[model samples]
Target chain A: MNIIETVSLALRSLRSNNLRTFLSVLGVMVGVGAVISVISVGMSAQAEIARNISDLGTNIVSVLPNFRDSASQSRLLQMMNVGLGREMLEAVPALSSVSAVAQVEATLAVGGDTARATLMGVEPSYSKIIPTDTAFGRWLVIADLSVHSQVIVLSSSIASELFRGIDPVGKQVWVTAGERRRPFVVVGVTEAEEDEPASGAGRQAFIPVTTMVYRLLPARNVSMYLGQTRSASDTDAAVAQLRRFLSLKSVDPDAFEVSSQQALLDAMKKVTIIVTSMLTVIAGISLVVSGLGIMNTLLTAVAERTREIGVRKSLGARNDDIRAQFLVESVVLSSLGGMAGMALGYAGSMAVSKALNWPPAFNWLSVVTAMGFSTLIGLAFGVYPATRASSMDPVTALRCE
Target chain B: MLKLERIVKDYDAGDIHVRALGGIDLHVTRGDYLAIMGPSGSGKSTLMHIMGCLDRPTSGSYLLNGRDVSRMNDAALARIRNREIGFVFQQFNLLPRETLQANVEVPLMYAGLGARQRHRMSADALRRMGILDRAHHRPSEVSGGQRQRAAIARALVNSPSLVLADEPTGNLDSRTGREILDILDSLNSEGVTVIVVTHDSEVGRRARRIINLKDGLIDSVEAAADEHH
Candidate 1:
């Protein structure tokens, strides 16, 4: 018989047993739905990480002293004393700008209110390497470092804490470290970064690196150097150049660590892949379970329809016809479940992304893969039952009640 | 025409072999109306099954319309059943879930007819059976007589050379049984070979020829006078 007739026969049987049909396909629907939703969620997290990395400037690279041991720390301190940041800029031609960073803990006294905060000393190029906008006044300029100006830039939270409801620009604050206190005028108040507030963007104060090293914290050493490439695409080359320069300047090749945003992105991509595969495996288990469900249901259906098989056989339906009828029924069941699962998965991903305020990432490849896999599952699980139905003897089957 | 020579059918019931039909020889010409009558376990059902091609004889030479079908495979027998013979069981055997029209269309569907042609032929068969108005009604929704008529329509829809009925009127009242026999009589008059297996003498009286089966063998064959008088 033709496909249409086979399909009609299958559909007629399914329609007569609607609840059984629905129950039989539910496993496939849930499995596919879970797979799709998990894939979309993974893609969304991947995109979020990528966006954060790009937000940190893809063209920027950071070089930090590897202070694994006290010996290396002392060596790194001695290297910092010799102005390694300037030497790095002079050695790497791919680097457009470089900034040195020194950090210390200090108490700030402003209008008789004391707030302890991390004091970061950096060059004017630091603003360019890690882009930030000022909510109030101007950022430190090259002239400010050349003249050892006593000017400070406060994060929005620090500014509010130090000088509540009033603009802190041009106001004097005392930075007391150890037995010395230095007066500095606030130059700018940096805008708040809501997404990454914990990344030292809300409670720190910035001053010229020269002022910090020569005046406030005379014994402090530079902790890290931030470098920017001439173009975003040249970040890898710039990192290599910086690594070579730092290795030549240091006693050990592993004394300094240099990394770019691309390195971070690669690491994040690895994590995303692992997570995606892990979720896929879990979903695969569900799919297999559902495949078993299909097998079980179809076997029961074959048993239940033995008389019908006999009737059809006596009416001239060949064994192949009966087999095709059952096979088509299962395929229809799984494919229909797959379609419904796809829709459910899409909605699930959208709901999760909305709840988490994440961008919804739809992967068409996952959709296609899920659909193809579900169809394959149907065919794979449909074989035994169809064979059983087709192999039944017409005489014995007709004698069945 | 159908011919059977020394047909034997054996069944293995547990370790004991049961001979359901023993060396039965029969011949039926085209347009012949025949009835088979016997008590239960007299091999009447077995004979009907073998005649309808639903069972294979253990040893026999059977021919239908000049084609030897005795040693044919199940698939080949299915083709013969689809194209050469139609069956109406005592239970009506109408698919309870399908409408009368779909029930009639089953054999034609197995015959590989297209949907449009199958519909037309099924409707025509139902019309001929005088149950066209109930074509869309499922078997469960109709009375026993209507269901049997629908079964007859299914049997005739494929236009087979022979129509076999196993107690076609066993589940019906006398009036409905007579109505079904009348339809069978008219079909036989229209040059279609009809065979009925029944225990009811009233049903046997309607056939032109009757074979009484006893203990897996034919006891006697009777030819009746024309009922027109």
Candidate 2:
């Protein structure tokens, strides 16, 4: 018979035993569904990580004091005294710009309202390194730093809170820490970055580092230095140069830590790969089990249909015809299961994405791979049963009950 | 025309080799109606299987329309079965899940007929068998006589040169058995070669020629009077 007739015949037989067909294909469906859902979640997570890293500025690197262990905490604190200031960082040939920031937790009082906030002391170039744009007024400039101006940039939410629907630019706010009240002029309001954690959005305020050291907190030391490389490709070289320079001046060379967005992304990708592979291996086992299910089901079918096979053989069905019919039945079963599993996986991913507030990503490569694998499983597992059916002796089969 | 010379068939039951058919010779021509009669274990079924090209004899020469098929491979035998032989089993071995029309289309399907043509030919066969009204009914859904008619339609659907029926009415009532025999008689009268294998003397008496097999050899050949036809 033609392929269409053969397939229809197989389908008719399957339909006669609908529940068996469904049960036989369930293993494959669940296996494919698990694989597709896991891959999609991994892809979306990878995309989110990439987006967060890019928001941190691809060419920028942060140098922090490494708090390796509580035993070395005192030594680390002492090593932090070694100056890795803007001039020293900018003098590195690989770096294009540098900014040093020192932060303190303080209460700010503006227009009879008080709110807790992180007060950051930063240079003018800090805006360039971290890449934030002001929603109103202007950013701190070089002259502000040279003059040691007590000028501040408030985030959008803070500006709204302090100004109460009025423009906070050019207004003065009081920053108090332990009864030490200092007045700083709001020069700019920075826009809130999208997709930031709700806790970090409006709690930060930036002021000139010179102003912070001279007026706000004279005892607080620089907390971290942020630098931008001349080119994205030069970030590693810049980080290496800064590390070497800091190590030479510090008593504890291991206390200095430098990291870039690319480094963080690489580390995150490694973890993602491991997680995805582990999930895929688990799904692969299910697929193999499902293949075994197909074999068992087909073998049973062959045994049950021995007399039918005899009748067909007597009616002139060639060995290949019988073999083809069974093979087509198996492949059709698995491919249909794969398609259904894809739909289930997509719906599952969407539900998970909604619950987790993440964007659902549909990975086509995984879909194709899963489908192809299932089809191959059908072919691989269907062979023995189909061959058994085809090779039956007509006389003996006719005698079968 | 068909010819079988010195047909011998053997079966190995463990280490013991049992001979099913020993040195049988037979010839049949177009429009001939013959019956092969024997008790159980007389190798009648083996001879019928060999004649239908379902099994190859241990030593024989079978020629159908001048083509030697004794040494043919499985695929070649299948082709010969498709185009040259039609079989009706006593059990009415129709696919239980298929409608009568589809049951009749089995041989035509293997003959590689197109769907529309196969459908038309199967319908015609069923119509000729006087069961066209029940073409869409499954085998289990039909009566024994109707199911046998469907089986006969299946045998004739391919317009094969030889129609081989093994105890065609073995499971039917006396009336249904007589009806099936009358259909076979009409088919033989219409110039279609027909062979029926049965152990019943009454069934054997309906054919124009009866070959009674004793053990693995033919005991007698008799000409039965065609009184009913």
Give the true-structure RMSD of model 1: 2.7
lDDT of 1 by residue, A60-152 (tens): 898888888998889788788426777888888889988999888888889788777788889888888889788999888888888889999
lDDT of 2 at A232: 87
TM-scores of chain A, one for each prediction: 0.92, 0.90
Model 1 agreement with the true structure over B1-229: per-residue lDDT tens digits? 8899999999998999999899999999999999999999999999988898888899988888888888899889999999988888888877878999999998888888888999999999999988899999999999999999998899988889999989998899999999999999998989999999999988888888999999899999999675831
For residues B1-229, could you state the per-residue lDDT of candidate 2 as single tens digits? 8899999999998999999988899999888989999888999999999999999999989888888888999999999988888899999999999999999998998999899999999999999999999999999999999999999999998888899999998999999999999999888888899999999888898888999888788888999986865
Stretches > 4 Å off in candidate 1? A1-9, A105-109, A112-118, A160-165, A176-181, A192-202, B225-229
lDDT value for model 1: 0.87
Point out where model 2 deviates above 4 Å.
Answer: A67-83, A88-90, A110-113, A147-149, A166-183, A195-202, A211-220, A240-255, B15-17, B225-229
Name the top TM-score candidate. 1
Root-mean-square deviation per candidate: 2.7, 3.0
Interface Cα RMSD in Å, per prediction: 1.1, 0.7
Name the lDDT value of residue A192 in candidate 2.
77
